[model samples]
Target: MLLESLSPLSGMINLVLVLLSVLTSAFTAAVGVGGGVLMIMALAQVMPAAALIPVHGMVQLGSNVGRTAMTWRHVNRAMLAAFLPGVVLGALAAAWLLVRLPAGVLELSIAAFVLFTCWGPGLPKRALGRGGILIVGAVTTLLSSLVGASGPVVAAFIKQSQEGRLAKVATFSACMLLQHLSKAFVFGVAGFVFRDWLPLMLVMVAAGFVGTWLGLRLLHWLPEHRFDNLFKWALTLLALRLVWLGGQRLAGAG
Candidate 1:
Protein backbone atom coordinates (compact mmCIF):
# COMPACT_ATOMS: atom_id res chain seq x y z
CA MET A 1 0.00 0.00 0.00
CA LEU A 2 2.66 2.51 0.98
CA LEU A 3 4.77 1.52 -1.99
CA GLU A 4 1.86 2.13 -4.30
CA SER A 5 1.43 5.66 -3.02
CA LEU A 6 4.96 6.78 -3.95
CA SER A 7 4.03 7.31 -7.55
CA PRO A 8 6.48 7.84 -10.42
CA LEU A 9 9.13 5.89 -8.51
CA SER A 10 9.56 2.17 -8.43
CA GLY A 11 10.07 0.46 -5.08
CA MET A 12 13.71 -0.02 -5.92
CA ILE A 13 14.20 3.66 -6.65
CA ASN A 14 12.54 4.65 -3.42
CA LEU A 15 14.85 2.32 -1.52
CA VAL A 16 17.85 3.80 -3.33
CA LEU A 17 16.90 7.38 -2.47
CA VAL A 18 16.26 6.44 1.15
CA LEU A 19 19.72 4.93 1.38
CA LEU A 20 21.16 7.96 -0.34
CA SER A 21 19.53 10.18 2.24
CA VAL A 22 21.33 8.28 4.97
CA LEU A 23 24.72 8.46 3.29
CA THR A 24 24.50 12.12 2.32
CA SER A 25 23.24 13.14 5.72
CA ALA A 26 26.14 11.37 7.33
CA PHE A 27 28.58 13.00 4.93
CA THR A 28 27.37 16.50 5.77
CA ALA A 29 27.29 15.85 9.50
CA ALA A 30 30.87 14.60 9.64
CA VAL A 31 32.63 16.64 6.97
CA GLY A 32 30.69 19.90 7.47
CA VAL A 33 29.49 20.29 3.83
CA GLY A 34 29.01 19.07 0.21
CA GLY A 35 26.49 16.34 0.97
CA GLY A 36 23.48 18.25 -0.22
CA VAL A 37 25.24 19.07 -3.48
CA LEU A 38 25.93 15.38 -3.97
CA MET A 39 22.40 14.38 -3.10
CA ILE A 40 20.87 16.88 -5.52
CA MET A 41 23.19 15.74 -8.27
CA ALA A 42 21.95 12.21 -7.79
CA LEU A 43 18.31 13.24 -7.62
CA ALA A 44 18.60 15.34 -10.76
CA GLN A 45 19.24 12.16 -12.66
CA VAL A 46 15.88 10.65 -11.64
CA MET A 47 13.49 13.40 -10.63
CA PRO A 48 11.70 15.69 -13.04
CA ALA A 49 13.21 19.17 -13.17
CA ALA A 50 9.94 20.80 -12.16
CA ALA A 51 9.70 18.78 -8.96
CA LEU A 52 13.40 18.60 -8.30
CA ILE A 53 14.13 21.78 -6.35
CA PRO A 54 11.17 21.62 -4.01
CA VAL A 55 11.46 17.92 -3.25
CA HIS A 56 15.18 18.16 -2.61
CA GLY A 57 14.62 21.23 -0.46
CA MET A 58 12.12 19.33 1.65
CA VAL A 59 14.44 16.40 2.15
CA GLN A 60 17.34 18.68 3.04
CA LEU A 61 15.11 20.64 5.33
CA GLY A 62 14.61 17.43 7.31
CA SER A 63 18.28 16.50 7.26
CA ASN A 64 19.39 19.92 8.47
CA VAL A 65 16.77 19.97 11.15
CA GLY A 66 18.04 16.66 12.49
CA ARG A 67 21.66 17.84 12.48
CA THR A 68 20.73 21.13 14.08
CA ALA A 69 18.82 19.36 16.84
CA MET A 70 21.68 17.03 17.64
CA THR A 71 24.26 19.82 17.75
CA TRP A 72 22.16 22.68 19.00
CA ARG A 73 24.45 23.34 21.94
CA HIS A 74 27.35 24.21 19.61
CA VAL A 75 25.47 26.61 17.34
CA ASN A 76 26.57 30.23 17.10
CA ARG A 77 23.56 32.17 18.26
CA ALA A 78 24.96 35.57 17.31
CA MET A 79 25.54 34.61 13.71
CA LEU A 80 22.16 32.97 13.44
CA ALA A 81 20.45 36.07 14.82
CA ALA A 82 22.18 38.32 12.32
CA PHE A 83 21.34 35.92 9.49
CA LEU A 84 17.58 35.80 10.02
CA PRO A 85 16.69 39.15 8.51
CA GLY A 86 18.63 38.35 5.40
CA VAL A 87 16.82 35.04 5.05
CA VAL A 88 13.51 36.84 5.17
CA LEU A 89 14.63 39.34 2.58
CA GLY A 90 16.09 36.72 0.32
CA ALA A 91 12.97 34.57 0.42
CA LEU A 92 10.80 37.56 -0.32
CA ALA A 93 12.98 38.54 -3.23
CA ALA A 94 12.91 35.05 -4.67
CA ALA A 95 9.16 34.89 -4.35
CA TRP A 96 8.79 38.16 -6.21
CA LEU A 97 11.02 37.11 -9.07
CA LEU A 98 9.75 33.53 -9.47
CA VAL A 99 11.92 33.02 -12.53
CA ARG A 100 14.58 30.36 -12.95
CA LEU A 101 17.98 31.57 -14.12
CA PRO A 102 19.93 29.78 -16.83
CA ALA A 103 21.35 26.58 -15.43
CA GLY A 104 24.88 27.07 -16.78
CA VAL A 105 25.12 30.64 -15.56
CA LEU A 106 23.93 29.84 -12.05
CA GLU A 107 26.16 26.79 -11.85
CA LEU A 108 29.26 28.69 -12.98
CA SER A 109 28.63 31.61 -10.64
CA ILE A 110 28.17 29.31 -7.64
CA ALA A 111 31.23 27.25 -8.49
CA ALA A 112 33.41 30.37 -8.85
CA PHE A 113 32.29 31.74 -5.52
CA VAL A 114 32.79 28.41 -3.74
CA LEU A 115 36.33 28.11 -5.17
CA PHE A 116 37.17 31.66 -4.19
CA THR A 117 35.92 31.14 -0.67
CA CYS A 118 37.97 27.98 -0.38
CA TRP A 119 41.31 29.39 -1.68
CA GLY A 120 41.12 33.18 -1.73
CA PRO A 121 42.67 35.45 0.88
CA GLY A 122 40.71 35.38 4.08
CA LEU A 123 38.32 38.18 4.86
CA PRO A 124 39.24 40.59 7.65
CA LYS A 125 37.87 39.79 11.11
CA ARG A 126 35.27 42.51 10.89
CA ALA A 127 33.97 41.13 7.62
CA LEU A 128 33.38 37.77 9.24
CA GLY A 129 31.06 39.28 11.78
CA ARG A 130 27.39 40.23 11.77
CA GLY A 131 27.29 42.30 8.59
CA GLY A 132 29.08 39.79 6.48
CA ILE A 133 26.93 36.97 7.78
CA LEU A 134 23.85 38.94 6.95
CA ILE A 135 24.96 39.31 3.34
CA VAL A 136 25.91 35.67 3.15
CA GLY A 137 22.53 34.70 4.48
CA ALA A 138 20.64 36.76 1.90
CA VAL A 139 22.72 35.78 -1.09
CA THR A 140 22.97 32.08 -0.36
CA THR A 141 19.31 31.75 0.52
CA LEU A 142 18.34 33.43 -2.72
CA LEU A 143 20.63 31.11 -4.62
CA SER A 144 19.31 28.03 -2.85
CA SER A 145 15.76 28.85 -3.81
CA LEU A 146 16.78 28.61 -7.44
CA VAL A 147 19.55 26.01 -7.38
CA GLY A 148 18.24 23.30 -4.92
CA ALA A 149 21.56 23.07 -3.04
CA SER A 150 23.59 25.97 -1.71
CA GLY A 151 25.10 24.08 1.21
CA PRO A 152 28.64 24.30 -0.18
CA VAL A 153 28.39 28.07 -0.55
CA VAL A 154 27.07 28.46 2.97
CA ALA A 155 29.70 26.09 4.31
CA ALA A 156 32.47 27.95 2.48
CA PHE A 157 31.37 31.24 4.04
CA ILE A 158 31.25 29.68 7.47
CA LYS A 159 34.64 28.03 6.90
CA GLN A 160 36.22 31.46 7.16
CA SER A 161 35.22 31.64 10.80
CA GLN A 162 37.59 30.53 13.54
CA GLU A 163 35.06 28.33 15.28
CA GLY A 164 35.99 24.81 16.26
CA ARG A 165 34.81 21.83 14.26
CA LEU A 166 31.63 21.13 16.22
CA ALA A 167 30.57 24.75 16.28
CA LYS A 168 31.15 25.04 12.55
CA VAL A 169 29.07 21.96 11.82
CA ALA A 170 26.33 23.05 14.20
CA THR A 171 26.15 26.56 12.81
CA PHE A 172 26.20 25.35 9.22
CA SER A 173 23.32 23.02 9.98
CA ALA A 174 21.34 25.79 11.60
CA CYS A 175 21.88 28.14 8.69
CA MET A 176 20.92 25.48 6.19
CA LEU A 177 17.82 24.68 8.22
CA LEU A 178 16.66 28.24 7.88
CA GLN A 179 17.53 28.37 4.18
CA HIS A 180 15.58 25.20 3.44
CA LEU A 181 12.67 26.45 5.51
CA SER A 182 12.54 29.58 3.40
CA LYS A 183 12.68 27.42 0.32
CA ALA A 184 9.68 25.41 1.55
CA PHE A 185 7.66 28.56 2.00
CA VAL A 186 8.60 29.97 -1.38
CA PHE A 187 7.82 26.74 -3.19
CA GLY A 188 4.58 26.31 -1.30
CA VAL A 189 3.46 29.77 -2.42
CA ALA A 190 4.58 28.99 -5.94
CA GLY A 191 2.05 26.15 -6.01
CA PHE A 192 4.27 23.13 -5.64
CA VAL A 193 2.13 20.37 -4.16
CA PHE A 194 4.32 18.95 -1.45
CA ARG A 195 1.72 16.45 -0.26
CA ASP A 196 2.49 14.17 -3.17
CA TRP A 197 6.02 13.70 -1.88
CA LEU A 198 5.39 13.75 1.85
CA PRO A 199 5.53 9.99 2.46
CA LEU A 200 8.88 9.53 0.76
CA MET A 201 10.27 12.67 2.34
CA LEU A 202 9.29 11.41 5.77
CA VAL A 203 11.06 8.11 5.28
CA MET A 204 14.13 9.86 3.90
CA VAL A 205 14.16 12.24 6.84
CA ALA A 206 14.04 9.33 9.27
CA ALA A 207 16.98 7.67 7.56
CA GLY A 208 18.80 10.98 7.61
CA PHE A 209 18.46 11.26 11.38
CA VAL A 210 20.08 7.89 11.86
CA GLY A 211 22.92 8.93 9.56
CA THR A 212 23.39 12.21 11.39
CA TRP A 213 23.81 10.38 14.68
CA LEU A 214 26.48 8.10 13.28
CA GLY A 215 28.27 10.94 11.52
CA LEU A 216 28.43 13.04 14.67
CA ARG A 217 30.19 10.15 16.34
CA LEU A 218 32.75 10.11 13.55
CA LEU A 219 33.11 13.87 13.85
CA HIS A 220 34.29 13.43 17.41
CA TRP A 221 37.08 11.06 16.39
CA LEU A 222 38.49 13.20 13.56
CA PRO A 223 41.41 15.51 14.29
CA GLU A 224 40.96 19.22 13.64
CA HIS A 225 43.70 19.46 11.03
CA ARG A 226 42.49 16.41 9.17
CA PHE A 227 38.94 17.68 9.25
CA ASP A 228 40.08 21.02 7.84
CA ASN A 229 41.93 19.42 4.96
CA LEU A 230 39.11 17.02 4.20
CA PHE A 231 36.57 19.79 4.21
CA LYS A 232 38.62 21.98 1.92
CA TRP A 233 39.44 19.31 -0.65
CA ALA A 234 35.90 17.96 -0.67
CA LEU A 235 34.51 21.37 -1.48
CA THR A 236 37.22 22.05 -4.05
CA LEU A 237 36.49 18.84 -5.92
CA LEU A 238 32.74 19.51 -5.90
CA ALA A 239 33.26 23.05 -7.15
CA LEU A 240 35.52 21.85 -9.95
CA ARG A 241 32.85 19.34 -11.01
CA LEU A 242 30.33 22.15 -11.09
CA VAL A 243 32.68 24.10 -13.34
CA TRP A 244 32.90 21.17 -15.72
CA LEU A 245 29.16 20.54 -15.72
CA GLY A 246 28.42 24.24 -16.16
CA GLY A 247 30.77 24.42 -19.15
CA GLN A 248 29.14 21.41 -20.74
CA ARG A 249 25.69 22.90 -20.24
CA LEU A 250 26.76 26.17 -21.83
CA ALA A 251 28.29 24.38 -24.81
CA GLY A 252 25.12 22.39 -25.33
CA ALA A 253 23.02 25.53 -25.10
CA GLY A 254 25.20 27.40 -27.55
Candidate 2:
Protein backbone atom coordinates (compact mmCIF):
# COMPACT_ATOMS: atom_id res chain seq x y z
CA MET A 1 0.00 0.00 0.00
CA LEU A 2 2.80 2.38 0.90
CA LEU A 3 4.66 1.57 -2.30
CA GLU A 4 1.48 2.06 -4.29
CA SER A 5 1.04 5.45 -2.67
CA LEU A 6 4.57 6.48 -3.65
CA SER A 7 4.20 6.07 -7.40
CA PRO A 8 5.03 9.11 -9.56
CA LEU A 9 2.53 8.68 -12.44
CA SER A 10 -0.33 7.21 -10.48
CA GLY A 11 -2.67 8.46 -7.80
CA MET A 12 0.29 9.81 -5.87
CA ILE A 13 1.47 12.21 -8.55
CA ASN A 14 0.33 14.99 -6.34
CA LEU A 15 2.88 13.67 -3.93
CA VAL A 16 5.44 13.62 -6.71
CA LEU A 17 4.42 17.15 -7.56
CA VAL A 18 5.18 17.96 -3.98
CA LEU A 19 8.58 16.37 -4.46
CA LEU A 20 8.99 18.45 -7.59
CA SER A 21 8.12 21.43 -5.47
CA VAL A 22 10.94 20.53 -3.12
CA LEU A 23 13.39 20.02 -5.96
CA THR A 24 12.53 23.31 -7.63
CA SER A 25 12.60 25.14 -4.34
CA ALA A 26 16.10 23.83 -3.91
CA PHE A 27 16.84 24.75 -7.50
CA THR A 28 15.89 28.31 -6.71
CA ALA A 29 17.94 28.11 -3.53
CA ALA A 30 20.96 26.80 -5.35
CA VAL A 31 20.71 28.89 -8.52
CA GLY A 32 18.63 31.82 -7.26
CA VAL A 33 15.59 31.28 -9.55
CA GLY A 34 12.93 28.74 -10.59
CA GLY A 35 10.91 27.66 -7.57
CA GLY A 36 7.14 27.42 -7.98
CA VAL A 37 7.16 28.56 -11.59
CA LEU A 38 8.34 25.22 -12.90
CA MET A 39 6.23 23.34 -10.42
CA ILE A 40 3.19 25.45 -11.32
CA MET A 41 3.57 24.75 -15.04
CA ALA A 42 3.98 21.05 -14.47
CA LEU A 43 1.02 21.05 -12.15
CA ALA A 44 -1.03 22.90 -14.71
CA GLN A 45 -0.51 20.07 -17.17
CA VAL A 46 -1.36 17.42 -14.61
CA MET A 47 -3.96 19.11 -12.44
CA PRO A 48 -6.07 20.85 -15.04
CA ALA A 49 -8.75 21.68 -12.49
CA ALA A 50 -6.44 23.84 -10.42
CA ALA A 51 -6.58 27.63 -10.55
CA LEU A 52 -3.12 28.57 -11.71
CA ILE A 53 -2.11 31.71 -9.82
CA PRO A 54 -3.47 31.39 -6.31
CA VAL A 55 -2.83 27.68 -6.06
CA HIS A 56 0.72 28.17 -7.18
CA GLY A 57 1.07 31.38 -5.20
CA MET A 58 0.55 29.73 -1.86
CA VAL A 59 2.91 26.89 -2.71
CA GLN A 60 5.49 29.38 -3.90
CA LEU A 61 4.99 31.33 -0.73
CA GLY A 62 5.81 28.25 1.29
CA SER A 63 8.81 27.34 -0.82
CA ASN A 64 10.43 30.77 -0.82
CA VAL A 65 9.76 31.27 2.86
CA GLY A 66 11.61 28.02 3.48
CA ARG A 67 14.49 29.01 1.21
CA THR A 68 14.71 32.40 2.85
CA ALA A 69 14.81 30.79 6.26
CA MET A 70 17.68 28.60 5.15
CA THR A 71 19.63 31.42 3.51
CA TRP A 72 18.55 34.41 5.59
CA ARG A 73 22.09 35.60 6.05
CA HIS A 74 22.42 36.56 2.41
CA VAL A 75 19.31 38.74 2.03
CA ASN A 76 19.68 42.19 0.54
CA ARG A 77 17.50 44.47 2.57
CA ALA A 78 18.51 47.55 0.66
CA MET A 79 17.49 45.97 -2.59
CA LEU A 80 14.16 44.78 -1.22
CA ALA A 81 13.32 48.17 0.21
CA ALA A 82 13.50 49.75 -3.19
CA PHE A 83 11.48 47.14 -5.03
CA LEU A 84 8.66 46.63 -2.52
CA PRO A 85 6.64 49.74 -3.26
CA GLY A 86 6.22 48.87 -6.91
CA VAL A 87 5.26 45.36 -6.01
CA VAL A 88 2.55 46.63 -3.74
CA LEU A 89 1.26 48.82 -6.51
CA GLY A 90 1.11 45.96 -8.95
CA ALA A 91 -0.62 43.74 -6.44
CA LEU A 92 -3.28 46.32 -5.88
CA ALA A 93 -3.93 46.45 -9.59
CA ALA A 94 -4.19 42.69 -9.84
CA ALA A 95 -6.59 42.61 -6.92
CA TRP A 96 -8.77 45.51 -7.95
CA LEU A 97 -8.34 46.56 -11.57
CA LEU A 98 -7.29 43.67 -13.76
CA VAL A 99 -9.60 40.93 -12.62
CA ARG A 100 -11.42 40.48 -15.91
CA LEU A 101 -8.74 40.18 -18.56
CA PRO A 102 -9.66 37.52 -21.10
CA ALA A 103 -7.90 34.45 -19.86
CA GLY A 104 -6.03 33.26 -22.98
CA VAL A 105 -5.23 36.71 -24.19
CA LEU A 106 -3.60 37.70 -20.94
CA GLU A 107 -1.63 34.50 -20.76
CA LEU A 108 -0.38 34.82 -24.32
CA SER A 109 0.63 38.43 -23.83
CA ILE A 110 2.45 37.53 -20.65
CA ALA A 111 4.13 34.65 -22.39
CA ALA A 112 5.27 37.02 -25.07
CA PHE A 113 6.46 39.47 -22.46
CA VAL A 114 8.55 36.78 -20.85
CA LEU A 115 9.97 35.73 -24.17
CA PHE A 116 10.91 39.31 -24.90
CA THR A 117 12.54 39.57 -21.52
CA CYS A 118 14.47 36.41 -22.18
CA TRP A 119 15.58 37.34 -25.67
CA GLY A 120 15.62 41.10 -25.41
CA PRO A 121 19.02 42.70 -25.53
CA GLY A 122 18.46 45.83 -23.50
CA LEU A 123 18.01 44.64 -19.92
CA PRO A 124 20.63 45.61 -17.40
CA LYS A 125 22.18 42.83 -15.40
CA ARG A 126 22.39 44.96 -12.23
CA ALA A 127 20.84 48.04 -10.73
CA LEU A 128 20.94 49.55 -7.24
CA GLY A 129 19.06 51.88 -4.90
CA ARG A 130 15.40 52.87 -4.87
CA GLY A 131 15.10 53.58 -8.56
CA GLY A 132 16.50 50.32 -9.77
CA ILE A 133 14.87 48.20 -7.13
CA LEU A 134 11.47 49.79 -7.63
CA ILE A 135 11.68 49.17 -11.35
CA VAL A 136 12.64 45.57 -10.78
CA GLY A 137 9.89 45.04 -8.24
CA ALA A 138 7.27 46.71 -10.36
CA VAL A 139 8.15 44.88 -13.55
CA THR A 140 8.57 41.49 -11.95
CA THR A 141 5.45 41.86 -9.84
CA LEU A 142 3.39 42.94 -12.82
CA LEU A 143 4.56 39.99 -14.85
CA SER A 144 4.15 37.60 -11.96
CA SER A 145 0.65 38.86 -11.29
CA LEU A 146 -0.38 37.97 -14.81
CA VAL A 147 1.53 34.72 -15.29
CA GLY A 148 1.55 33.05 -11.86
CA ALA A 149 5.36 33.06 -11.46
CA SER A 150 8.33 34.43 -13.35
CA GLY A 151 11.34 33.26 -11.39
CA PRO A 152 13.63 33.68 -14.34
CA VAL A 153 12.94 37.38 -14.71
CA VAL A 154 13.55 38.01 -11.06
CA ALA A 155 16.69 35.91 -11.25
CA ALA A 156 17.94 37.79 -14.27
CA PHE A 157 18.04 40.85 -12.11
CA ILE A 158 19.44 39.20 -9.01
CA LYS A 159 21.99 36.93 -10.65
CA GLN A 160 24.16 39.86 -11.64
CA SER A 161 25.44 40.04 -8.09
CA GLN A 162 28.67 38.49 -6.96
CA GLU A 163 26.93 36.78 -4.05
CA GLY A 164 27.61 33.06 -3.79
CA ARG A 165 25.01 30.30 -3.63
CA LEU A 166 23.49 30.75 -0.19
CA ALA A 167 23.32 34.50 -0.48
CA LYS A 168 21.76 34.32 -3.91
CA VAL A 169 19.20 31.86 -2.63
CA ALA A 170 18.40 33.91 0.46
CA THR A 171 17.95 37.21 -1.32
CA PHE A 172 15.95 35.67 -4.17
CA SER A 173 13.72 33.85 -1.73
CA ALA A 174 12.98 37.05 0.13
CA CYS A 175 12.01 38.81 -3.07
CA MET A 176 9.74 35.95 -4.16
CA LEU A 177 8.05 35.78 -0.76
CA LEU A 178 7.07 39.42 -1.02
CA GLN A 179 5.78 38.90 -4.55
CA HIS A 180 3.79 35.84 -3.55
CA LEU A 181 2.34 37.70 -0.59
CA SER A 182 1.14 40.37 -2.95
CA LYS A 183 -0.37 37.76 -5.26
CA ALA A 184 -2.16 35.88 -2.50
CA PHE A 185 -3.66 39.06 -1.19
CA VAL A 186 -4.81 40.07 -4.63
CA PHE A 187 -6.33 36.68 -5.43
CA GLY A 188 -8.09 36.58 -2.10
CA VAL A 189 -9.49 40.02 -2.69
CA ALA A 190 -10.58 38.96 -6.16
CA GLY A 191 -12.75 36.26 -4.58
CA PHE A 192 -10.98 33.12 -5.70
CA VAL A 193 -11.94 30.13 -3.54
CA PHE A 194 -9.21 29.23 -1.06
CA ARG A 195 -10.28 26.81 1.66
CA ASP A 196 -9.83 23.77 -0.57
CA TRP A 197 -6.44 24.92 -1.80
CA LEU A 198 -4.99 25.15 1.69
CA PRO A 199 -4.51 21.41 2.14
CA LEU A 200 -2.96 20.97 -1.30
CA MET A 201 -0.58 23.86 -0.75
CA LEU A 202 0.50 22.29 2.51
CA VAL A 203 1.45 19.12 0.68
CA MET A 204 3.35 21.03 -1.97
CA VAL A 205 5.20 22.95 0.72
CA ALA A 206 6.40 19.76 2.36
CA ALA A 207 7.64 18.52 -0.99
CA GLY A 208 9.37 21.81 -1.69
CA PHE A 209 11.42 21.52 1.50
CA VAL A 210 12.87 18.18 0.45
CA GLY A 211 13.36 19.23 -3.18
CA THR A 212 15.31 22.29 -2.14
CA TRP A 213 17.62 20.19 -0.01
CA LEU A 214 18.38 17.85 -2.89
CA GLY A 215 18.90 20.65 -5.40
CA LEU A 216 21.32 22.36 -3.04
CA ARG A 217 23.18 19.11 -2.52
CA LEU A 218 23.44 18.57 -6.28
CA LEU A 219 24.75 22.09 -6.79
CA HIS A 220 27.67 21.37 -4.52
CA TRP A 221 28.97 18.73 -6.93
CA LEU A 222 28.19 20.36 -10.30
CA PRO A 223 30.36 22.94 -11.99
CA GLU A 224 28.95 26.46 -12.02
CA HIS A 225 28.87 26.78 -15.80
CA ARG A 226 26.93 23.59 -16.21
CA PHE A 227 24.39 24.69 -13.64
CA ASP A 228 23.94 28.10 -15.25
CA ASN A 229 23.53 26.64 -18.70
CA LEU A 230 20.99 24.14 -17.50
CA PHE A 231 18.93 26.87 -15.87
CA LYS A 232 19.15 29.05 -18.97
CA TRP A 233 17.82 26.33 -21.21
CA ALA A 234 15.15 25.47 -18.71
CA LEU A 235 13.81 29.02 -18.70
CA THR A 236 13.99 29.25 -22.46
CA LEU A 237 11.94 26.11 -22.83
CA LEU A 238 9.42 27.26 -20.24
CA ALA A 239 9.00 30.58 -22.03
CA LEU A 240 8.48 28.94 -25.39
CA ARG A 241 5.91 26.51 -24.08
CA LEU A 242 4.01 29.22 -22.27
CA VAL A 243 4.05 31.30 -25.41
CA TRP A 244 2.50 28.47 -27.38
CA LEU A 245 -0.13 27.86 -24.74
CA GLY A 246 -0.91 31.54 -24.59
CA GLY A 247 -1.22 31.77 -28.34
CA GLN A 248 -3.60 28.87 -28.46
CA ARG A 249 -5.66 30.49 -25.75
CA LEU A 250 -5.69 33.66 -27.80
CA ALA A 251 -6.87 31.77 -30.83
CA GLY A 252 -9.62 30.22 -28.78
CA ALA A 253 -10.63 33.62 -27.45
CA GLY A 254 -11.01 34.88 -30.97
How well does each candidate superpose onto the true structure, as a TM-score? 0.95, 0.78
Question: Model 2 off-target regions past 4 Å?
Answer: 1-13, 46-50, 99-129, 161-163, 246-254
Task: Report the C-alpha lDDT of model 2 over 1-254, residue by residue, as the tens digit.
Answer: 44234323354765677667767787766655655666776877865443777778888888878777776777887877777897898787766665556756655555565555556663454554567778778777876777675676676566554355555566778988999888878777777777755666777788787877776677677777776666556566766776777778778878
Judge candidate 1 at residue 124 and give its lDDT: 78
- Root-mean-square deviation of Cα positions for candidate 1 versus the true structure, in angstroms: 1.4
Clashes of 2: 6
Candidate 1 lDDT, tens digit per residue, 1-254? 66656646777788889999999999999999888988899899988898899989989999999999999999999889988988998899888786676758878888898898889987778878888889889888888897775788888888987468899899999999999999888998899888878888899999999999989999999999989988999889988988998999998888
**With candidate 2 superimposed using the best TM-score fit, by how many Å does residue 194's alpha carbon deviate from the native?**
2.2
lDDT of 2 at 69: 76
Q: After superposition, how far is residue 201 of candidate 2 from its true place, in Å?
A: 1.4
